[model samples]
Target: SSLIGYGRGDVRNTVGNIPMEWYQDYPHIGYDLDGKKIFKPIRNKDELDEFLDKMENPDYWRTVHDKTTASDIRLSDEQVDLVHRLQKGQFGDASFNEYEIHSCSSGPIVEKKKILIPFSVSKMVHAIKMGWIKPRKPKETTPQYYDLWAKEDPNAILGRHKMHVPAPKMRLPGHEESYNPPPEYLLTEEERLAWEQQDPEDRKLPFLPQKHSCLRAVPAFSRFIHERFERCLDLYLCPRQRKMRVNVNPEDLIPKLPKPKDLQPFPTTMSLVYRGHTSLVRSISASPTGQWLVSGSDDCTVRFWEVNTGRCLKTLEVGGAVKGVAWNPNPAVCLVAVCFESTVLLLNPALGDRLVVGATDQLITSYEPPEEDKEQAVTWALSEGPEHDKGHRLTLTHPKGVKQVVWHGKGDYLSSVMPDNTSNLQVLIHQVSKRRTQNPFRKNKGLVQCVSFHPLRPYFFVATQRCVRVYNLIKQELTKKLTANCKWISSMAIHPGGDNLICGSYDCRLAWFDLDLSTKPYKMLRHHKKALRGVAYHKHYPLFASGADDGSVIVCHGMVYNDLLQNPLIVPVKVLRGHQITHDLGVLDVTFHPTQPWVFSSGADATIRLFT
Candidate 1:
């Protein structure tokens, strides 16, 4: 074997076996009497004797350490010593002085020195001297556990000091508790009475965790918990609320609209009840002359009645329920166009104006017109609707059912919507004289809510769920895509000036969009209590109205000035509430009178109201 472990077998690690005198005489990488390091070996007995002579004078010193032997601050030796002594100091009274931990909270609960830094004076002094922070004054000490434990001696070897701590907690008495203590010992008068009022059956066992009300909400615990824990949680996260602002004053670009206070209040009266339909009325229209009011119902009939009287005038059995009705504005010939199923019937109500068509059952059974007039009478119908109606009838095809219908300014063009299915067509426009139909959509978007044609220009608007698209009719290209930033478009009313449009949404928002003021709605009204069903802009007045399913109507003045720089006026005029809700349904439609401030509203309650 090599001499590395010759006959030793790990016993070489024993240090006690060596002579202490020889260990002392060795100069093994240590300092001399003058505090100078010496690492050289002793080669002879004389050198060993020299080392032993040096060792006779013991030398003790601490190492001057550095983080990396590089000083950015270039601290002096005295400063380094001061830092070291400051670290070792407990109370900033003396360097390297010992301090026994004392806690006023629970009679010196912690005997460890480092755990008492919160109550130390040196920590605050070091923060003031080195960190440039103002030292916090030490508070007078009060021992919380002095009553439970024996009084502590302030002059003892272990240092004593005060500490901030909560009041002593309530605990179950020791094993010596032989009887139930009075309520006064544990609870206040109010708590004692509340505890006494508790039913014996609902009382829980003692000593186990008890269910209590919220800490801050419970008045009994207000002394201990002054604020709710939610305040602290709110500091970390915010809460949600309505972001809309009401009663905001308009800018100087516009002024408030003035109205007469003595005029007939809205919801004038139930002057007449036009009720002849067996089912719900889906569409209602007043003639351009305001002489006759026409209505379509689910009972498969289109009825015309005198607007002044409740008497029914004419009822045409188109063999299906009526969905839409509109009167051509040409006074030379009053054309009553009706949409039943997918077909539009153009009936000349002028000749048969005297007697109601369905006044007697025989009128409906024998109301066949002459064969020569059938071609012009049944003007236009979708190829999909009423396939059994035999005759050479003028017809136009549509992709879906027509929900709403509107006439152009000259009564030459027509626009209608089909909200159900937009597979091939969303809006259809038909030219009566040319007998040609044009569909304005190329792709199926969301549920098409409504469509309106420009009064004079060659453009039309189609409103989908959240967006409204404007397209030029002649060029067959989109011109503008207006975003309402609302949920589910419900209705739209375009201004006669052709520069602004107002939209109502199911989110209870009334948004006004300006073509010149940007595609986004410039102003929004979000005060409706429920989903808005219909909206209308008066033809001659500056008034605009929005109706909701909550049976309330809000009228706002939305007249934008002629000047480009002036802001639009949008002051809420009034909230007319007189319609009665029926079977969870309210106002279904609202329309403004073309010539007057009067507005007509239809509700699910089977009543039509004329509000002037």
Candidate 2:
């Protein structure tokens, strides 16, 4: 191993640049050139020997420890001289000179020659390469090209607008900006201090008013350069646009609509009022022939009324508050379904035709189930003795309260909604002829608000809190889900055409959905001030009505066109107000007459009103 010094090969340690303390306890400090351990030098100097060596040795001052070899290295004369030169801030190599002159004339030089070509020759070569100078026409037809350089009228171009607007002129200098001004326009000492403290943009005047002896005596404007810079910034940063003003008649903006007077056959005024119930009337229904109307009330009574006159034909005490009442839509049958608590009473009503009433009673009691069939969702029992005397032929007992009952178009089948959350028993379809019940849904989506049967198809609609589901009874599968986009749906009604439907919500919104268009609501109408309790569509007229808690019924003409491309036109025609708000409740249910353009509404005022 050799020492690392100036002008000496540094090939001592074979272990690379590592700390010497790692080998303190080992016998060998490092490896040598042949990969063999270099043993540490033996000194074994005592304190007296070290003192004697320091006193006698003349080169002790230049001695340094070499940890790699565990020995002491002495500086040579040449190394000492180099160290002295480095300490004096001079170059270590004595032969090297820092400042030296260089000359380019001593090397051989070559000159470059410039060559130029004619511009026409290069252009001809480029044209030949691009085939612009063809010898003959090609066999294939060439693409058509537009002659951009052809002469044409500049005004005939499409993008060239004829209108040209000039920049707005700056405002003239006000009296306050004059070098000399009236005394009233001058600022007080307090006002001057306030102006200086305020923001530049907030100041009322851009310049301070002053009085000068004469025009010649006025000093040069002090803020001329700053004002010019601000003006330049406004021009560059702020965008200015000039819009054309259009003159249009205000009346032309309104849509042209037929006058209400022209839409005559619709109900315009109250024609009758049947008062019999002592409590709030919850539901109302008109018979198929529009001759009789039945209503159910919270007073535990159901009243049958004559549509032509304001007379309560009969009132039967059911022992429980009635929740819903629906008349058979088929003119061939004379029956009414009244739901109260957990029981639904199929009453003949016995008001229309005698033969029809008798046939309805017999039709309801003709069903007899087999002895082995014991899994019905509802228990069917005959209404005997006193109940039969009151026209109640059959009674349907369910496990939960039946909120509503809707009959099929054929009048042989009916469905009920119980809204029971404990079990998946919210909806049940009943076939009166067979006296059998079927629970269509095994798992309820949410609280079932209402249920309805399609007017023409074998479909059922069940409305939950936020959406409405359409089920095809024939297929026994969900056909489509209509997004009502409401907080809480209260009721639903299908149009006679069966292509559209409307849902009323407790959030005072009415959403219309087109089955063939989209599942999402086609239009959302908010014309009621309070929650909507009931909504009904006319059987033959292009009209629909809504009863709200605000004690008002709004009738709108909803004309549905046969063309698929045209949207339905909705127009509010009348607002019938007669039922008074009682205990935060108003009109509870509404139904349209089957044959006439009239409507019947049962309200919390314990009365039924007919508008004709």
Candidate 3:
């Protein structure tokens, strides 16, 4: 039929053919020429009948396949015969079952069964794969029927078997009550009777003493025990029973000798030699001959004194506050170098002569360059001509002024260190020649507080805030640098032997270091109560002197080969008090005679004292 223009009510065109739309939804089923579901083609009716028979026998077919088809849609007799032949192996005479044929014809009915009844299909498939679902034997029953018969009286069968029994209770005769005793009566009746059976005197037990208490009563107890035990033994009963009397002697105690009498006290007397000033004295020095002593002071002048007589011989006015006085080593003539606030005046006390070198502008009448070129060229001048020299003569212009001026022992060189609170250290090194070869030694990072040249060497030592720099004049180089433990190293002195160096610091400690060793100091002399400002070594003896801001000059004696622990010697032997002369005071300088054991010390009290 030429079917065309079909509508929703077009039954005539789709009567015997499956619609294409329905076939699209159920593509696995066979479709008619029109592409619509006509019938689900079954290739194995026998396998389906066998599966339905098994399910119907268990009353599960109504729940599984009743919704798909009714028995009224029967197969033809030919189809039935074909199914029987397929089931009973009549078609090929091969040993194949209906389930196997169904499984081979259908793409995967087992997979469909797995999706529908997963648990049953999985168990059956496992049994079939393991050969457990084979045809039943002729005399054996199936496991399903056997299991159904076995569950008939499961509870009765379990009841007939004996069950496990708990263990019987064990009642110990006396332990039952013993495990929990009565609190009111802890001891048992037999125990009480046994305790009562003990002797009354023993029951009232002897009090055992503690170890310490027994020790305290040992002596008395020992005597009593000895007496009683001796009496009871009676081996040597009475004295009268023996023919001769026996004597028992006690141990003899040696007497202690009385301590020897202490050493008798020695009378001490100190001799004060020369003291001839009314105000504070700042510095002192002894002449190289040990005959003359020079002292400078705030009194603005220096006084020369005889060593033996303690008499003042000369008084020269060095304008400004005199801070330091150093004596030259010439005997017939006494040369004194005085450090004033703004000037350094070299004087010959015997000749009443003075050479004023460093002059501040405030102390000068006029600031004029020397008219004569030879006179104008004072420092580092190569020639005596004015045209060639360009350096100006160094004039000290410090307000606080020149603090110290030291003359070399040979009298050929003079050094002056001035503090101006600036980066440059005002050091003037003048060669005292006919034609002056003056060189300014001016490389100090801070204020140069103290300077000292080695006693017999050309090496000079300078003390600053932190370190001591040793400069070698021969090598023209700084040879060594030493870290001073004291922050402000105010004073330094070289030992007479030149092996040891002593430095005093603002920390009130005098430390002595061996020049040969730069490590820790050998010894520290802590006698000063305040900052020690002056230190001088004795030229002859092993003595040294220290002057401190506490207005005291201490003469320390015996710093020779002596150990502080075994033979302590470097202690103050004499302390010269300055408070009697001034209240707020300090000692500026101290010196010893080159030959004698005399000490000369000057302080802020404006007085110099000679001590022996």
Candidate 4:
């Protein structure tokens, strides 16, 4: 770029001649002594007026001319006098001392000489600059800013002045520095759980879900892994729903299945209703013989009823409320696993119809109400009394209480998850032959979501917030970890073939992961309206179902084919919506009939619906 020359023009001559408002935005403009652009702030209207008054005098002009000429020869009075003496031929020492000089090549020996001047100039320059001499007044003339005659003339440059709004001053905005509180300081009850969940140490990763020790060794890294996965899948890690929608493709659609006539009549009618529990039923299991349906309820009892009739054949008083119910897969064993507050009780329902024997710990000693403002409360706490051995019972104790109990393929071993254990040993493995309980981890990995035994091998998989880890029970070490491509897993089901796995999340999301494909889910579907609670794959049919807190169940024909030319298909056959929510609760658990195209759904409404 080249510079533009303004010649002799400067702010001293041009700015004052322009309109006054121009100074508000023009900043400062002037010219240096060498006629280059320079800025000289006039400061205010008062300073500008004073500068204009002085510049307009002819005496000031004369002083400027004299100062400019004398600047080169500027000297003191004594120096000027010495110069005059030198002009009359005065000198100090003319004789050169050649012997004193070491050598001519060493360096030059310098001497001072006085320069001549035509006249003494110091007094004249200083007097003019200091205002010792008054400026001579020239022919009086009006100031350009107030000259109405020149402004009225159209030929003049400023005479045709245009009225335009002056531009505002230039500025940039900046934020004030302040302190921000830590996230924990701002958390409510719900937010507190989620904030603490950022640290793996604060989260329980039961059943070797994420290798809690290694991940806990670096809490930041563990949270990053979990958070990044949830972020990528667009699922809310918190308990509440986030409004952001996930990205989807056309392939994400759940293909509609053509209704088969045999299954058509089955879903259209509710064949049987098993209603015996006084309170809400949380767990249910169908018998392998298809003759019995066992259910555990919050009323602190387990009941066995015939599948054909809606009658409760037998009821057993287990001290603690039953949290989970699992039927043994082996026909030879034919045992039913029941989870209590702190014990896993395995019972063979066919042995006898007798009540479990245990000394009751008084739940409430007295119910004394106020004499005037009578307030009554009932204690439903578990009875912790002396242990009594029942011949058909296998009791395994978990100190922190159990949330879920899962059975292995042959029913020889079972795994249980403790929701109360935040630090160590939340996953309990009970061996029937050993008659004892065992834990896998010393520290938690994350909040345990679900656990299941591998269909074919000795491995069992545990699902946490954002990871799926499978451990080989024989070796007692983690064999594989699925760096999941999904969000918080609420419930999971493995295909009977042991090839495909499906996990449903609290954010109303469903992911189907193929073991042979990759650690990431092969398909992701979000068709439910609430958090998922249960998922099951039919043992005999090419179907899978998911139940949620929205009081509905989705039955899909998810048949897997190994042919390279054929793609495994998933078709949503039906959406069963009969379960009514109670106390903000919906379907608690779901299971399929082994041989029929029938699905059983249970909810907090205290009614079991059998679709056959």
Candidate 5:
């Protein structure tokens, strides 16, 4: 693990301790050890001088320096010279015979060597005590620091720099009173005459015309003349005026007056009867009698509950994401339509049996009889024509996934909003009937996130990316479009009376507007922390429920008065929370039972919850 090493050794002279040459024999210094060379030692000053002279030469110094330097070692001048000279110039025969340099250089020499020391606490302490290091003191307080300290003290006397406050009444050239007219002299006699002579129509009065007589003289004069003439004429014509004779008796002349109608006061508050699952709820539907409640949720199930008991009567598993659940208007059968991601199932809740009405693989089929008897016979007889095989064939109807399917209250039609797989931003409306008519309500250009038919009106509201379009079913045109200034409409719900519409947006705001006015939201319910997914209006109460990505369902009350001109009186009546509700696991849909006060919410967690 050690990368570098340092040690101490013996040499009589120290020019800088660095390796020179290998030594041999006992007491050897510069000579290689474990060899034949013995310690002859430098006998006198002359021998020492000769050795030093050999080591000092620059040419000799370079050779030793090259070896130590190339190996990343430090070398002394004397040692460098000796090694360099030994490696320089070819050895002559006389010089080789005259002396053996290694033997002469070897000697018993004792030299103190310094070794590198490791840093430790003791070393640091020693360094500090030896005055090799200085301790630093903390810095003085900064201005901000002093200010904070002063704030803590409360009673500390502080010194503030002198500041010059300018005089309050500094006179500017135009503001000086010397050139301005005094109060009394503002109007000169000649100026007053000129003003008085000006035409009343051309005059610009300081106060309103009625406040002063300067401009009111003509009107007042006209009124006075009219009153005088009216008085004189009344007196003059009183005697000569013709009088009509009564043609009938006073009793007959008096006709009967209709009686005044009594005013009926609206109810101030309505009762909210919460009845559904004990867990998170997704979608809810009420029976035709407005007695029983049905709700579906991410719990992968639908639950039937008694509206008055708040009791969960039956829970049935649909085995998929339960988006919407609705009760058939028929009170006896209590058919519940549950919509899954790829399929919609019509469930007989009474029998606990479910039938898949439509699926991704099942295509919508239209049956038609042949135009003529011969054509019908040919179609019946042909085995392989385009129109031959028409019975009991599965067709893929919805290419894009079905998000929601709502049936008209009267069961005259069933409408489904399906996302276009080619573009989720667009939605296709499919209506089912014996005679399937093209949706008189044209398809939306932007993504239709949600669609709901008005409870009473012949219009259904469709929420798009930037606007809410109300389509008139009877007129077959978009009756009104509510634009939300670049805000994406995430969900929409119509008031029970079908007079108002509530919309949730990606901007984390809930808005309601009158069906007739859409320029601005009348009531803005701002409570959701994220984009709202679904909104449901209570059938009996003034309350509405909205579900957001925050894993919470918020109930806003009193949204009926919301018009573009009035702020809706909305208050959060309840909040339901359970899952983490991440970006992907946002609550997707919500619905309220028409008869009961139950709410249901479907979330991305693949679980649905029923809340009362």
Candidate 6:
């Protein structure tokens, strides 16, 4: 074996343990610690010089060859003596004697002396004999044994039966399992063989049913014991869950509401019936003072009636069927606007104060159009020649038939709806005082179901088939669109507060929308059995009513709160029934008295009924 050394001028070779013969042909022996080549020393001596140096050197016998450094190392006298001693089977260290006795001068050696103990055993025995050292006494106990398979006492166990589930009850055997079952229940031979060959879980029945000819011929069930064992296994191995049933009263599920008796002052019964028209009364309106009422019918007649006496004071025969009628909501004006065919007639009812009626007529007929005025969608003209004598002071002519007309709150502006699809002339706003007509919409959104004016603001509501669009007339832009959440809308009415609106649909649903709440309806009501034809809101009371084709009017108490965090309260209170259904048409129109809780409904029976 060769050794490597690290010294001042030379570093140990980095080449790991291997034979030096592999580097015999190279000039360099191996690489050093720095990975530099370690060159072989130059040897110029021949055999004669080597023999002469060996004979001349005095320490030749003590010289040793180092293979790592490829050099000779001379040994010192002490090193030579150590080598001789080691060769003679003695200790490698010169001062260490092999035959010396070991001893400690300070005290006897005490560690790792297993053969000798420091204390005397005889002294401990003497102490025990003298009672100087004592032993602990054993504790006394009585041993008891119990049966391993004994049943535990239920009361003695802590919370042993909490959340325990009772085992499921077994299903009772049907008639097919009877000993003398019907012939249809008896299995054929092939079915019996198939049942025998199928897996137990796949079999529909635990045992085959047989139709015994007589009761005595029936034998005992063969799988009864096996079935009992399987049932026991299922009860022991299957997992069970505890189900907590909540007992609740059915009445508790209903929402709390005030009784109808407490929510009184709503129209409950028929008060008067104005009967004159020979056909269905399509529209009706009451004066702002609630003293007079007017109705238009399909019989081509418009009648004015005293609201209290139900007496028809005047009847003007129109040339066409009257579709809608609206009285000016302004208490200062006494004018009624009636729609039929393609024209709307502005009529002075002449029933109230004569001065107010005269003022209304003069206000309507005073406007004169400029000669340079351009043509419009609606043509405004005065009642000409003989037509002037019949109370028709002004006539609004449109390009198509108009379906409905509603007046603005101020009595100066009114809007008419014409569901014409051939042109963009569906809704036209007319200023009665100026005798001017202007189209509010550039294009039709859908078939115009109805149109209404906001009671307090400049907002106009145009209801289409599925939505009601509120447009600000002053801004000339869309303000908000309300989703009806029902099929085709039939009529709409705004609350006098101008913050809430109600729309009646042909699907027999009434949707109430809070303009400040959301674009969707706040509540949808479905009380009418037939499609709703008209809806009206009382101006002074927190009451609203809807007339449907079922010939019944339903009045509901609708109270709106001023708090934005709270929703409106609606409670159905009364259902007034008197009008007879005719030709599939029941209530054609409904309107409320401006200042009272009274609601008037015009039906297809050609009679206008008032509920107070």
User: What is the Cα-based lDDT of residue 553 in candidate 1?
Assistant: 74
Cα-lDDT of candidate 5: 0.55
lDDT of each: 0.64, 0.87, 0.60, 0.67, 0.55, 0.86
Q: Quote the positional error of residue 291 for candidate 4 in Å.
A: 1.1
* Candidate 4: clashing pairs of residues: 204-446, 205-445, 205-446, 266-612
Estimate, for each residue in 541-591, the C-alpha lDDT of model 3 and write its tens digit. Answer: 777778888877777664555333443235445666643335655766777
TM-score of each: 0.51, 0.61, 0.48, 0.51, 0.43, 0.62
Highest TM-score: give the candidate number.
Answer: 6
Candidate 5 C-alpha lDDT tens digits along 1-612 = 111222354212321355434232225332222333234354344777757857885554332212211222345564445456667854423236443324434344311111223346669989999999999998998664233223323354332422234447863422112233345535566866776888887764432222222443334345788898878988879877756686887887754432212111112222333443343455666676656666666567677766565566776665565667666553333345567665555554443222322321122233442344322100112112332222212111343456776766665455566655345333333333222323343345777777777777787777777888777877878778787654788777777777777788888888877655555676677888988878878777777878888878776565455445664455555566754465444776776655556565566664445565
> lDDT tens string, model 2, 142-258?
875444434345553321433334558997676777778888889999999999999999998877799987899899968899999879877886786546599999999977888
**Sliding window of 10 residues with minimal summed lDDT for model 1:** 64-73
Q: Which stretches in model 6 have alpha-carbon errors above 4 Å? A: 1-247
Model 3 weakest 10-residue run by lDDT: 259-268
Poorly placed runs, candidate 1 (over 4 Å): 1-271, 351-399, 420-422
Instruction: List, residue by residue over 5-113, the lDDT tens digit for candidate 4.
Output: 2235522233223343333334444334556544434334477775885778534422221111111123444545555666777642335453462444533332211
Clashes of each: 2, 0, 9, 4, 31, 0
Model 2 CA lDDT for position 288: 86
- lDDT by residue (9-90, candidate 1, tens digit) is 3212222233333334344433334555444343454777757745773431222212111111234556456667779863
Better of 2 and 3 by lDDT: 2
Error of 6 at 134 (Å): 24
CA displacement after TM-score superposition, residue 81 of candidate 6 (Å):
89
In model 3, residue pairs whose N, Cα or C atoms come closer than 3 Å (at least 3 residues apart or on different chains), thus clashing, are 18-36, 19-36, 279-605, 279-606, 280-604, 280-605, 280-606, 281-603, 281-606
